[model samples]
Structures are given as structure tokens and as C-alpha cells.
Target: MDQFTINLLFVGASFAIYIGIAIWARAGSTSEFYAAGRGVHPVTNGMATAADWMSAASFLSMAGLIAFVGYDNSAYLMGWTGGYVLLALLLAPYLRKFGKFTVSEFIGDRFYSPTARLVAVICLIICSVTYVIGQMTGVGVAFGRFLEVDNTTGLLIGAVIVFAYAVFGGMKGVTYTQVAQYIVLILAYTIPAIFISLQLTGNPIPGLGLFGTDLASGEPLLQKLDQIVTELGFNQYTAHDGDTLNLVLFTLSLMIGTAGLPHVIMRFFTVPRVADARWSAGWALVFIALLYLTAPAVGAMARLNITQQFWPNGTDAQAVSLEQIETDPAYDWMATWQQTGMLGWEDLNGDGLIQYYNDASPDMQERAAAEGWEGNELNNFNRDILVLANPEIANLPSWVIGLIAAGGLAAALSTAAGLLLAISSAVSHDLMKGQLTPNISEKGELLSARIAMAVAIAVATWLGLNPPGFAAQTVALAFGLAASSIFPVLMMGIFTKVNNKGAVAGMLAGLLLTLLYIFLHKGWFFIPGTNSFTDAEPLLFGIKSTSFGAVGALVNFAVAFAVSKTTTPIPARIEDLVESVRIPRGAGAAAADH
Candidate 1:
């Protein structure tokens, strides 16, 4: 079969499995819908959590970001994965012991204030919604490439599928579906990587092959990649040269944000016990590490492959001729990617050769002038497409290409479903049943959940059709919102005796300040025309928008403490709640009481 047909087959088969599971496991009650009736096994819940947390950003964008930027981007890997350790140690077990269906519920009950809960709900919606927009964009991109549809059409299709499965299965349905998704996405990610690694390094395992000797040059693969990229004026593959302070802060921010994200925290509610929650977090990291460990290898190898393609005979030799690119089947990858409108090239000087060098490099400029090359002609090469283009570039089997297509879509769709679930449950369970209509019937609340999910999907589809900016940047805003607002309040609720007023004040200050800072840098509502600083030149000590989450988190902690000093302390009962949460014994009975 052709690559397109193969891709369709893989994606269609995977989607079929998810929908089938949703049908088999349809949620029927508040417990099932919100927490899967608290019967899910720890290992199963962990796999589900992995699917929910990884999102499109981890699967599609992280490696591409690393490949294009070099070791400076290792912060993403360390930050995302290391955050789970914090989740396990600091948050997951206690939150599960709290025995709540939602993160907001825990806040509201522990703080003895509906206002605090409402603030948490607002934070959850903002963070999850912004994050979902990025996932939706990934869905559209995946569909457009594999199904040959436009982004808008692909987004609408993806949204409808998500609504059908998510509304029907709720957490129960989404959990099982996500377990299947994790499998598809992992297989799809690793197989092609293994092929490419073995081709270059003569080692079977992509992870080990990254450090193994290159088959062609008989030198360490990473060492050769570092030498070649640096010769072309880029950073070494294994070298780290970013701001150490900023790198540490960014990694810490991602960790706190990960532990605090409602969608991820809610996964713990699905398991049956506090001990199970701890085990689930460990398993989730184990599954996540499967991809995280492979990512550095993929990034390093892809960079080496792309750079070597440009400088086949060496940096001093002439670039590959257009005739060679047109005639060679190996170069067909460029033609295929061009059809997606993500890859393009032009010969500005009328030379048949294509130059893929940084135009700003002084030595490269001098060499270009001597060679009579004009301005750079490869006008646009999105960093996001590097992984998607990798299997094609290596000329892997058509089925492998198809599997990757399905895997990328699965990653996007799985996370979008999880986020939409969080949004809908917050609106229906927290806002409607808990606050607006405390007497609302179970069936009515379930209906409300479905309606809210549909509306959320509609909004996400619209935003995805017109994505605000880069995937990584939009996701960073979501993380900043979660880190600054939700994380501190949750921490205070568990670790301190901050009064209701203090918690509420801290949440509002964090949410508003973080949103304002992000808007100043990323435009209000992310519209293109309104911005004061490029992300590169953000306000407040030249911290980029991506790195501002840590600062916002700090601001949240400071404001919460400042407010606590002036207010009446939390009730003694609330202090007991914190102590009760710290221990594992008697948690099951406490949850059962709720």
C-alpha cells in the first residue's frame, strides 16, 4: 500500500480501538464519570495518567524543539519527567487520600470555603483550556498530514471524535482508551527511532546507539554529531551552554506545574487507595521514561542526519545540487514534506544547490560570498515537523510511517480528551452541582457534563483552527497559569494553615498577575496584533515568557504567605485535615465517608 493508505489504516485502527473501549466502558454515575468508581488498578491508572499527561507537546514537539535548538533544550526533558517525582512525593498520595473527585473539591473542602474552590475551578479551566488548544493544533496538524485534509477540517473531525468518546466514557471511558493510546503512541515513537539509530550507529537499541560508535566514521555517534554541527556554527550536541539559573528555574517550574495540573491530579482519584496512588505515579513515570529516555537519542540522531544530508562530502565541499535532489529517491522526503506546506526551498542565486546554513554566522557569510551564494533560500522549515519528517527521511517502511502518523494523532487526541474531561467536570460537578444547584439530580448533572464537554470541544476546535503561536509557547502559558495559581494554593492547603481569605487572595493574585504577564508578552488572548515585548525580550529581568512560570509561582507563594500573616489562621479542624492527609493509615475509611 501507499504511505497515505498505510497511515490511514493505522490511525483508523487505533481510533476504532479507543471508540470500542469507550462503548464497552460507558460511565453511568458521578463516581464512574469522575473517578472511574475508584476501582482502577494502580498500574492501569498509571498508564492512563501517562497518556493524559504526555499530551501533544511531549510526543510531537519536544524532540523537534531539542533537535533544532541543541542541548539548551534539555530543560524540557528534565523538567517534564522530573516533575512526576514531585507529584509522587509531594501531591499524588495525599490528594488521593483526600478522596475527592476533582482538585477543586479538595481545595474547597480543605480550606472550608467555596470561594477557594471556585478560584481553583477557574484556574483549572484556564490552564486546561489553553493547554487543550495546543493539543487541538497538534491533532489538526496530524490529521492534515496523514489524511490529506486542511487544518480546519481536520480539527473539526478530531473534535467530534473526542466529544463522542469523552462524553460517553467520562473518566472511566477515557482511562481505558488512554491505556490503549499509550501503547499506540509508544510503539509508533520507538520503532522508527530504532530503525534510524541502527542505520547510523550499527547498534540495535536507539537509546544505547546514541552513544555508540558511528558505523560509517567509527567515532562515537554523539561526538561526531557535536563536531559536525559546531563546524557549521551550531552548538555541540552534548554540550550545555544556556543560563544555568534560568535552566534550573524552568525545570523547577515545569515540575511544580506538572504536580499541580488538575487533569493529571484527577487521575489519582480513579485508583482505589492511597497506596495505589503512590504506585500509580511510579508506574506513570516508568511509562513516561520509556519515551523520555528515547527522546535525546532521537533528537541527536535527527540533527546528525539532517546536517549530514546538507554537508554530504564535508562543510568545505559544494552543497548538494538540485539535479541530485530531484533525481535521488532519498531527497523525495523533501518533496513529500513540501506537499504538506511545512517544508519549502528556493534557489535565490539561481544556483541548483540548496544551502541549509545559519545566514547570521560570520564565517558562513564570508564563505557564502566567496561561493557566490545569495540570501538563504530554504525560506521556512518549522522545527515542529522534524520528528514527523524523520521516518520519511530514513525511507522506513510505509507501515512504519503509518504507525507514526497514528501515534502522533493518538497522543494529541488522548490528551485533548483528558483536558476536555477536566473542563467539563469542573463546570458541571464543581460549578453547577456543587455551587449553582446543590440539589441537582445525578442525571441532570451528567447531562450538564456532556453539554459542557461539547461546548468546550467547539471552543477548542475554533482556537485550534487559528493557533495563536508556537506549540511550546502556548503550552508554557498554560503551565504558567497552573504553576502560579493552582500549585501554591494546593501546597498551602496540604502543608500550611493558611486561612480561607489567604488562600483565596493568593489564588486571585497568582491568576491575574500571571495572565497579565503572559498577555503582555503573548498578546491579550494571544491575538497577533497586541504585544509589548517579543518572548525573547519579556519584561522583568529579561526572563522569556517560557521561563516566567517559575517567577509567577514564587509570586503566588509570597502573596499567600503575606496574606496569611494578616488573617485569622485556618481552623483547628483544617490543621487536622493536613495531618490526616500526611499519613497512609485510615485513608480508605476517610475516603469512604465522603
Candidate 2:
């Protein structure tokens, strides 16, 4: 069968499974809609959390960024994976023991203030909405490429599918569907890496193959890659060349953001017990690590593969002739991806050859002058395209390519569903039922949840049509918001005797400051021409807006403490609630209290 048909088959089959699971696990009540009726097994919840946490950015764009930036990008790997440790250790069990349907509920009740819950709902909405835009964009890109549709149409199709599962099944449906998604995404990701690893390093494990000797060159795989890329005027793959402070801050931001994200936190509430929440986090990491550990290997190996393909003989040889690219089946992936305007080349010197290398290097400039080359020909290789194109680049079977298409869609849709659920629950449960309409019926609450989800999807799709940045970068902004606003308040609510006034003040400070910083640098509301400063000229202490979340979080902590010192103490009942959540004992009773 042709590639298009195979892609449809795989992607279609995966969607069918998700829809079926949603039907089977359709939520019957507000409890099922919001918390999966609190009956999910630990292992099952863990897999679901992995699928929910690892969005399109993790599956589609992260390795690609690592591939282009090398060791300097290792922070993404460490920050994202390490955040789960913080979650498992500090947040998950305690939150689970609190037995709330939403994170905002916990914050509101803990602080004994509807205003605090409302602030949390706003933060959750901002963070979830920002994060969902990235996922919607990913869905658009994946659907556009594989289904041969325009991005807007592809986005609509994806939105429809997500609406079907998310609205019908709620958290119950999303959880079971995410388990299926995790299976598809992991298999699609690893199978290609395994094949590429075996071909390049005589090892089946991509992680080991990344460090193992290259079979042809008899040198460490990374050493060979560093030598080849440097020969082509690119930086060494093993060197760290980015600003050290920004790197540290960015990593810390992602870690804290991961722990604080409402969507991931909500997953813990679905499991049966506080102990289950803890174990579920560990299992989630195990599933997440399967891809996380292999990602660097995929990035390094794919970079090497692309470099080798460009220079068939060696970097010293003449560039690949343009005629070869036009006529050779090996170069077909470029032509295919060029349709998306993401990968392209031009014969800049009219030499009828393609030179793919770093054009910004001074040494490369001198060599180009000596060789009568005008400029680099590969002018627009988008980082997001790397993983989706990996199987095609390696000439893998048509089925593997199809599987990858399915996997990318799964990754995008699962996270979109998860984020939408968080947004909906915050609006319906926390904002409306908890505060505005306390007498609302359970059926009315479920209806409101569905309506909130539909609105959130529409908003996300609209923003995705004109995304401010790539999938991962936009997601990073969401993380920054969460890191600054939600995570700190939760920690204080659980660990400290922070009063309602203090919690309210801290959330507003963190949320406003972080959003202000992001808007100034990333464009006002992420519109293209509204920004006063670029990331290269960050206004705050050489700290890029992307890395400012950690600082914002610190400001939240300090200000909350200072504000609390001047305020009244926590009420006796709220203190008892805090003490109750700190221990796993009587979690069953606590869960039943609401």
C-alpha cells in the first residue's frame, strides 16, 4: 500500500480505539467526570499520567531541539524528567489525600477563601489554555502533513475528535484513552530509534548506542558526531555553549512548572488512594523515562544520519549535487517536507549543489568565499519536523512511518484532552459550582463541564491557527506561568501555615508578574508585532522570559511569607485540614468527606 493509505489506516485505527475506550468508560456523574470516580488503579493511572504529561512537544519537538542544539539542550531532558521526582515526593500524595476533584478546590478550601480558589482557577485557565495551544498546533502540523490537508482544516478535524472523547468521557474517558495513547506513542517512538541504532552502532538500545562506538568508524557515537558536525562548521555536539545562568534557570523553570501544572496534578486525583498516588507517580516516571532516556540517543543519531546523508563521501568532498536531490528517491523526504514550508534548500551560488552547514561561522564564511559559495542552501529546516521525518529520513518501512503519524496525533490529542479537562473542571467545578452556583445540581455541573471543554477547545484552536512560537516553546510559556503561580501556592498550602490573605496575595503577585514578563518579551498576548523586546535582550537581569518563572516563583514565596507575617494566622479548622492532608492515614475518610 501507498504511504498515504498506510498513514490513514494507522491513524484511523488509533482514533477508533480512543473513541471506543471513551464509550466504554463514559463518565456517569460529576465525580466520574472530574475524578474518574476515584477508582483507577495505580499502574493504570500512572500510564494515563504519562500520556497526559508527555504532550506533543515531548514526543514531537523535544528531541529535534536537542538534535540541533546538542549538549546545551540537555536541560530539557533533565528538567522535565526530574520534575516528576518533585511531584512524587512533594505534591502528588498530599494533593491526593486532600480528595479534591480539582487543584483549585484544594487551594480554595485550604486557604478558606473563595477568592483564592478563583485566583487559582484563573491561573489554571491561563496555564492550561497556553499549553493547549501548543497541542492544537501540533495536531494541526501532524494532521496537515499526514492527511494532506491544510493546517486549519487539520486543526478542526483534531478538535472535533478531541471534543468527542473529552466531552463524552470526561476524566474517566480521558484516562483510559491516554493509556492507549501511551502505548501507541511509545511504540512509534522507540521502534524507529531501535532500527536506527542497530544500523549505526550495532546495538539495539538507542540509549546505549548513543554512547557506544560507531560500527563503521570504531569511535564513540557522540565523538563521531562531534567530529563530523565540527568539520561542517557546526558546533561540537558534546560542548555546552549557551549562557550558563539561563540554562540553569530554564531547567529549573521547567522542573517546577512540571510539578505545578494543573493537568498533571489532576491525574493524581483519579487514583484510589494517597499511597496509590505516590506509586502512580513512580510508574508514570518509569513510562516517561522509556522515552526520555531514548530521546537524546534519537537526537544524536538522527543528527549524525542527516549529516552523513548530506555528505555522502565526507565533509571535505563537494556538496551533494542538486540533480541528485531532484531525481534521487533518497532525497524524497525533503521534497515531501518542503510542501509544509518547514524544510527547504536553494542553490545560492548557482553551483547546482546543496551545501547544508552553519553559515554564521566566520571560518565557514572564509571557506565559502574561497570555494565561490554564496550561502548555505538549507535555509529553513524547522526543528519540529525532525522527529516526524526521522523514519522517512532513514528509509524505514511504510508501516513505521504510518505508526509515527498515529503516534504524533496520539501525543497531541491526549494532552489536549487532559488540558481541556483541567480547564473545564476549573471553570465548572471551582468557579461555578464551588462559588457562583453552589446549589447547582450534579447533572448541571456535568453539563457545564462539557460546555467549558467545548469553549476551551475553540479558544485553543483559534490560538493555534496563529501560534506565537513552535510547539515546545509555547508549552514552555505555559510551564512558566504554572511555575510562577500555581506550584508555589500549592506548596505553601500544604507545607506552611499560610493564611487566606497570604495565599491570595502570592497568587496574584506571581501570576501578574510572570504574565507581564512573558507578554513584554513574547509579544502582548503573543500577537506578532506587540513585543517591545526580544528574547536576546531580556529586560530582567539577563534572564530570558522563558526562564523567569523560577524567579517569579521565588518572588511568590518571599512575598507570601512577608504578607503572612503581617496577617492573621490560619483558622483552626483549616489547620486541621492541612494536618489531615499531610498523612496518608484516613485518606479514605477524607476522600469521602466531599
Candidate 3:
């Protein structure tokens, strides 16, 4: 079958399964809609959490970043996995023991202030919205290529499909649907990795193949990649040429951001008991580690494969000819991807060949002069396309290519569903029902939750069109915001006796400052062209905007403690509440009301 037809069959079948599950398990009550009726099995919840946690960023974008940015981007793997440990061990059991339906609800009750709840709702929405944009970006890319449509049209179609499932199913629907998605995505990701790894290194395991010697050069795969990239006038693939301080801050931001994410936190609320929440966290880590271990191998192998495609004989030989690109089956992936407008090249010197080396490299200037080349011919090769395009670039089977189409969509849609659920819950449950309309019935709340999800989808689609960076980088920014505004307060609420005023002030101080710094660099609300500065030359202390989340978290801590010292102490009853959450001696069933 043709590639497009094959892709349609796989993606359509997966969507059918997800939508069918949503229909079968459609939520009916507030408890069901908000926390899956608090009866999800620990193992099932863990798989679902893994699917939710490993969003478009983890599945489609992180490997792309690692492929291009090299050793520096290893921070993504470390920070994200470490952050899960913090959430599981440090936060999940306690939050479940506290027995709140949402993170905002927990913050509101723990701090004993409606205002604190309101602030938390706002924080959750901001973080969730920002996160959904990355998912949208990934959806656009996957659909744009597979559906043979432009990015915008693909994005619009994806938004509608996601909204239908999310609004119909709510938390109960999403939890189970995510489990199926996890199976599809994991199989899709690793099957191709095993194929590519065996081809490149004679090893079936992608992770082991990453460190194994290249079949052609008989050198370590990383060493081969390092030599290949450097000769192409790019930085050595194994080199760490980034700012140490910024790398530290960026990783710290992702770590905390992963913990602060409302959707991931909401998974713990769905379990039957506090121990279940802990077991769920542990199992989620195991599921997540599967993808994490394979990502570096995918990145390195993909980089090496692509570089060799450009220079089939070697980097010392002539680049791919226009005729081969036009007619060869091996080069067919290029024409298909170029339609997305994210990949392209030009024969700047009209030599009938596309030379893709880094023309700006000082070491390449002499080569350019000798060859009489004008400049580098490759243009607008977006980093986000690396992972999605890898199977095709390696000339894998049509079925493998089709499976990747399904996998990429699942990766993006699963996380987007979770994030939208978080946003809808915060709006309808935490903000509207709890504060604005305290007397609203459960039916009214449910209707509003679906409506809120629809609105969020619209907003995310619009912003995704003008995304400020690649999928993973854009996601890191969202993490920064969450780390700054949400993580510290959640930590303090669990570990300390910080007061309501302190929580509110700390949240605002961290959120506003981080948002402002991000806007100055990324753009005003990520509109694309309104930015006054670039990340390369940051405005202060040589820190990139993506790295500012760690600083923002510190500011939140400092501001919270300072404000608390000058404010009233926690009430006696609240103190006892804190003790109960910490000690984790609780009833079997979680109380329904927050």
C-alpha cells in the first residue's frame, strides 16, 4: 500500500480505539469527571501516567533535541526522569493522603484561603496551556506529514479530534485511553529503534547499540557520530560546548517543572489509597524508563544515519546529487517531508548538488573557497522533524513508517488530553464551582468543564501556530513557569507551616517575574516577532530564558518565607492537618470532598 494510505489506516485505527474507550467509560459524576472515581489500579494508573508524562516533548521532541544539540541536551533526560522521582517519592503519596481532587484544591484547603486556591487555579491553567502548545506543535508536524496537509490544517483537525475525546471522557475516560496509547506509542517507538540499531551496530537493543561500535567504522557509535558531525562543519556530536551555569539551571527547571505539572499530579488523585499512589509512581517510573533509555540511542543513530545520507561515500566526497534526490527510492523521504515546509534545500551555486555543511564554520571556509561554493544549501531544516522523519530517512519499511505516524500522534494527543483535563478541572471544579459558583450543581460543573476544554483547545491551536521554539524547547519554557510558580508552593505546603499570604505572594512573585523574563526573550506571549532580546544574548546574568525557572523557584521560596515571617501563623486545626498529611496514617478510601 502507499505510505499515505498506510499511515491513515494505522492512525485511524488507534483513534478509533481511544474514542471507543472514551465512549465505553464516559464519566457521569463530578467524582468520575475529576478523579476517575478514585478507583484506578496502581499499575494501570502508572502506565497511564507514563503516557501522560511522556508527552510530545518526551516522545517526539527530546530525541530531536539530543540529535542536534548533542551532549548539552542530555539535561532533558536527567531533569525529566529525576523530576519524576521527586514527584513520586516526595509529593504523590502525601498529596493522595491529603485527598484533594486537584492540585489547586489541595493548595486552597491546605492554605485555608480561597485566594490561594484562586492563585493556584491560575497557575495550573498557565502551566497547562503553555504545555498544550508543545503538544499542538507536535500534532501539527505529525499530521502535516502523514495526512499530506499543511501544518495549520493538520493542527485544526487534531484539535477537534482531541476535544471530542477529552470532553466526552473526562478523567475516567482519559485514564484508560492513555493506557492503550502507552502500548501503541511504546511499540511504535522501540520497534523502529531495534531495526535501526541492528542495522547500524549489529545490536538489537538501541540503548546498547548507542555505545556499541559502528558496523562500518568499527568505532564506538558516539565516536563515529562525533567525527561525522565535526567534519560537516557542525559541533562535535559528543562535545559539551554550552554554558555550565545555564545547563545546571535549565536541568533544574525541567526537574521541578515535571513535578509541578498539574496533569501528572492529578494521576495520584485517581488512585484508591495513599499506598496505591506510591506504587503508581514507582510503576510510572518503570514505564517512563523504557522510553528514556531508548531516546539517546535513537538520537545518535538518527544523527549518524542522516549525516551519511548527505555524504554517502563519506564527508570527504561530493554531497547527494539532485538527480539521486529526485529519482532514488532512498531519497524519497526528502520529497515527502519538504511538503511540510520544515525541510528544504537550495543549490545556491547551481551545481546540481545540495551541499549541507555549515558554511559559517571557520574550518569550512577554505573548503568552500576551493570548491567555489556560494554558501550552505540546506535551509529551514527544523530540529523538531528529526525523530518523526528518522524511519523514513533510514529507508525503513512502509509499515514501520506508518506505525511511526500513529506513535507520534499518540504521544502528542495523550499528553494534550491530560493537560486539557487539568485545565478544565481547574476552571470548572477549582475556580467556578469552588469559588465563583459555590452552589452550582454537579451537572452544571460538568457542562462547564467540557466547555472550558473546548476553549483551551482553541487558544492552544492559535498560539501553536506562532510557537517561539522547537517542541522540546517550548515545553522547557512551560516547565520553567511551573517550577517558578507551582512547584515551590506545593513543596512548602507539604513540608512546612507556611501561611496563606506567603503562598499567594510567593506564587505571584515567581510567576510574574518568570513570565516577564520569558516574554522579553521568547516574545510578548510568544507571538514570535515582538521579542526585544534573543536567548543567545540574554538580558541579565548570561542566563537563557529557559534556564530562569530555577531562579524563579528560588525567588518563590525567598518571597514566601519573607512574607510569612511578617504575616499570621497557621491556625491550630491547619497545623494538625499538616501533621496528618506528613504522617500518612489515613482511612482506606479518600474522602470525596476537598
Candidate 4:
């Protein structure tokens, strides 16, 4: 079959499987919709959580970020993975033991105030909405290329797909569909890496192949990549030239943000017991490790492949001619990606050849003048396209490319479903049912949840068209927002005697401060170029807008503590409640008593 037909078939099959699972497991009551009746086994919930956590950011954009920036982008890997560890180790078991349907619920009860619950709800919605925007961006990119449509059209289609399943299944349907999605995405990710590893380094395992000698050059894979990219006026593939403090802070922000993600937290609420929650967290970590370990290798190898393609004979030799790019089957991926408006090159100087060296590089300036070159012609490479385009870059089989089409969508949709559920649950359960209309029936609440999810999908689809950044960067901003606003509040609510006043104050303070910082650097999302940041100094001085989350967390903790000390202390009953949650023995029974 033709590549497009194969892609359609593979994607259609995956969608059928997802919608079928959603129909079979459609939620009936609030419990089923919100927590799957709290009956999901630890291992099952773990795999589902893995799929939920590994959104388009992880699946489509993480490796791409690493590929171009080299070791400097390792913060994404370490921070996201370590943040999961923090969530699992420090938060999940306690939240599950608390027996709340949403994080906002836990905050309200634990803080002994309905206003605290409302504030928590606001935080959850903001984090979730921001997060879904990133997922939709990935969805748009994946669907755009696979379906041969523009990003706006791709986003609309993806929104419809998500609305069909997510609005129907709620958490119950999303959990099971995510399990199937996990299998598809893992295979989609690793299979290509395995094929490329074997082809380039004579090793089938991509991770091992990374450190192994390249079969073509007989040099260490990273060593050869570094030499080639530097010779092409790019930095060494393994060098870390970014500010140390900012990288540390950015990694910390991602970790903190992971701790507060309501969708991932909601997964724990599906398991039956606190012990099961811990076990699921462990299993999710194991599943996540598979993608995490493979990512570095995928980035390095793909970078090497593209660099070699541009300088076929070597960096010292003549650049590939435009005529070859037009007629060569090997360059078909470029044409395909160009249709998405993501990958493009312009012949600025009317040269028959397209030289892709960094024209702005001081070392390349003399060479550019010597060759009468205007500048770099390959000017429009979006980092987010690297992974989805990887199979094509290596000229893999049509089936492999087809598998990726399905896998990338699975990655985006799974997380999007989970986030939309979180957003809907916050609106229906926390806002409408819990606070506004306490007498609402389960049936009414369920309908409200579906309606809320549909609305969220519409908003996310619109935002995806003009995303603040690349898939992963947009996600990092969400994380920073969550980290600043949500993580600190949850930690204090569980571990400290912070009063309701303190909790509300901390959330508002952190959120506003972080948002201001992001607005200054990111030009407040849609207006892209208004920000002062540039490629030479990506951060302000040394810090990025994304790195400010850790600072926000510190401010939150300080403000909450300060306000709590001055205000009325937690009543004796609330103190007892905090004590009960902390104690392990009879923790499950304590949850029941509450």
C-alpha cells in the first residue's frame, strides 16, 4: 500500500480501538467517572498513568529538544523523570489515603474551608488548561503531517477525536484506553530507535548503541556527532554551555510541576488502596523509564543522520545541490514536512546548493563571504518535528512510519483526555457539585462533567493553533505554573498546620508572581516577538521563564508559613485530621472515618 494509505489504516485502527474501549467502559456514576470505582489494579493503573504522564511533550518533543541543543537540554529528561519520583514518593499515597475525588477537594477539607477548595479548583483548571494546550500542539503537528492537513485543521480533527472518547469515558474510559495507547506508543517509539541503532551503530538496543562506536566512522557515536556538528558551525553534541544555576532551576521546576499535575494524581485515586497507589506509582516509573532511557540515543542518532544528509561527503565537501533535494527519494521527508510549514529551506542567494551551516556563527562568517553565500538556507526547522519525522529521516518502512502516526496521536490524546477529565472534574465535581449545587444528583454531575470536557476540548483546540512555544516548552510553562501555584499548596496542606487563609494566600501569591515573570519573557504567549529574550541569551541573565517555578515554590512556602503563624491556628479537629493522614497505621481506615 502507499504510505498515506498505510498511515490512514494504522491511525484508523488505533482510533477504533480507543473509541471501542471508551464505549465498553463508559462511566455510569460519579465514582466510576472520577475514579473508575476505585477498583483498578496497581499494575493496570500504573500503565495507564504512564500513558497519561507521557504526553506529546514526552513522546514527540523531548528528544527533539535534546537533539538540537545537545547536553544542555538534559534538564528536561532529569527534571520530568525526577518529578515523577517526587510525586510517587512524596504525594500519591497520601492523596489516595485522603480519599478525595480531586486535589481541590483534598485542599478544601484539609484546610477546613470551602474557599480553599474554590482556590484549589482555580489552580487545577489553569494548570490543566495550560497543559492541554501543549498536548493539542503536539496533536496538531502529528495530525498535520500524518493526515496531510494544515495544523489548524489537524487540531480541530484531534479535538473531535478527544471529545468523542474523553467526554464519554471520563476517567474510567480514559484509563483503559490509555493502557492500549501505552503499548502502541512504546512500540512506536522504540522500534524506530532500534532500527536506526542497528543501521548506524551495529547495535539493536538504541541506548547501548549511543555509546558504541559508529559503524560508518569507527568513532564513538557521540564523539563523531560532536565533531561533525562543530565542523558545521554548531556546538558539540555532548557539550553543556548553558547557565548551571538556571538548568538546575529549570529541572527543579519540572520536578515540582510533576508533583502537582492533577491528571496524574487522579490516576492514583483509581486504585483501591494507598498501598496500591504506591505500587502503581512504582509501575508507572518503570514504564516511564523505557522512554526516558531511549530518548538520548534517539536524539543523538537522528541529529547525526540529518547532519550527514546535509553534508553527504563531509562538512569539508560541497553542500548537497538543490537539484538532488528535488529528485532524490531520500529527501522525500523534507518535502512532506515542508507541507506542514515546519521544515523548509529557501535559496536566499540563488545558489543551486543549500548550505545549512550556522551563518551567524563568527567562524562561519568568513566562509560565507568566501563562498558568496547570503546566509543559512535551511532556516525553518522546528525542533518539535524531529521525532515524528525520525522514521522518514532514516528512510524506514512505511509501516514503521504508520505506527508512528498512530503512536504520536496516542501520546497526545491520552494525556489530553486525562487533562480534560481533570479540568471537567474540577468544574463539575468541585465547583458545581461540591460548592454551588451540593444537592445535585450523580446523573446530573456526570452530564455536567461531559459538557465541561467538551468545552475544554474546544478551548484547547483553538489555543493549539498559536501555541506559546514548542510542545515540550509549552508543557514546561504549564509545569512552572503548576509548580508555583499547586505543588507548594498541596505539600503544606498535607504536611503542615497551614490555615485556610495561608493556603489561599500562598496560591494567589505564587501564581501571580510566576505568571508575571513568564509574561515578561514569553511576551504573554500569543504575541511571540514582544519578549526580550533572544537565541544568544535564551534566559534573562541566566534564568529562563520556565526556571522561575522553583523560586515561586519558595515564595509560596514562605508566604503560607508567615500568614499561618499570624492568623488563627488550625482547630483541634483539623489538627487531628492532619495527624491521621500522616500516620501510616490504619491510614485507610482514617480515610473512611473522614
Scored by lDDT, the top model is 2
| Cα lDDT tens digits for candidate 2, 247-320 | 99999999999999999999999888888998999999999999999999999998998988888788989888
- How accurate locally is residue 519 in candidate 1, as Cα lDDT from 0 to 100? 85
Candidate 4 per-residue C-alpha lDDT over 1-594 given as tens digits, one digit per residue, 9 for 90 to 100: 899899999999999999999999999988889988888999999899999999999999999999999998999889888987888778898888888689999899998889889988988888898899999989988888999988888898999999999988889999999999999999999999999999999999998999999999999999999999998789887887877888899999999999888998889988888888888998998998899999999999999999899889899888888999999999999998888888899888897988999887888888899888889999999988999999999999999999999999999999999999999999999999989899988899999999998888888888887788788878888898889988999888777889989998898899888877887778855487787664345555657788988988898899999999999999999988788777556745644553
TM-score of 2: 0.99
Name the lDDT of candidate 4.
0.89
After TM-score superposition, the amount by which residue 134's alpha carbon in candidate 1 deviates from its true location, in angstroms, is 0.9
Best by TM-score: 2
- Model 2 ranges off by over 4 Å: none
Model 4: how far residue 331 lies from native, Å: 1.4
Residue 402 local lDDT, model 4? 97
- What are the root-mean-square deviations of the candidates from the true structure over C-alphas? 1.3, 0.8, 1.2, 1.7
List TM-scores for all candidates, in order.
Answer: 0.98, 0.99, 0.98, 0.97
CA lDDT of every candidate: 0.86, 0.93, 0.90, 0.89
- Residues 1-594 of candidate 1: C-alpha lDDT, one tens digit per residue: 787888888999999999999999999998899989899999999899989888888888888888878778888898888889878888888998888789999889888999999999999999999999899989888888889898778888899899889999999999999999999999989999999988998777888998899888999988888888777766666788777767777777787788778999999988888889999999999999989888888888888888788777887787778887789888888887788788898888988898777777787688779989876667778777877889878888889889988999889999999999999999999999889999999999999999999999999888888788767767867888888888888888888888888888888888898888888887888888798887666688767776777778888888888988998887888888889888878877866776
Indicate the worst ten consecutive residues by lDDT in candidate 2. 585-594
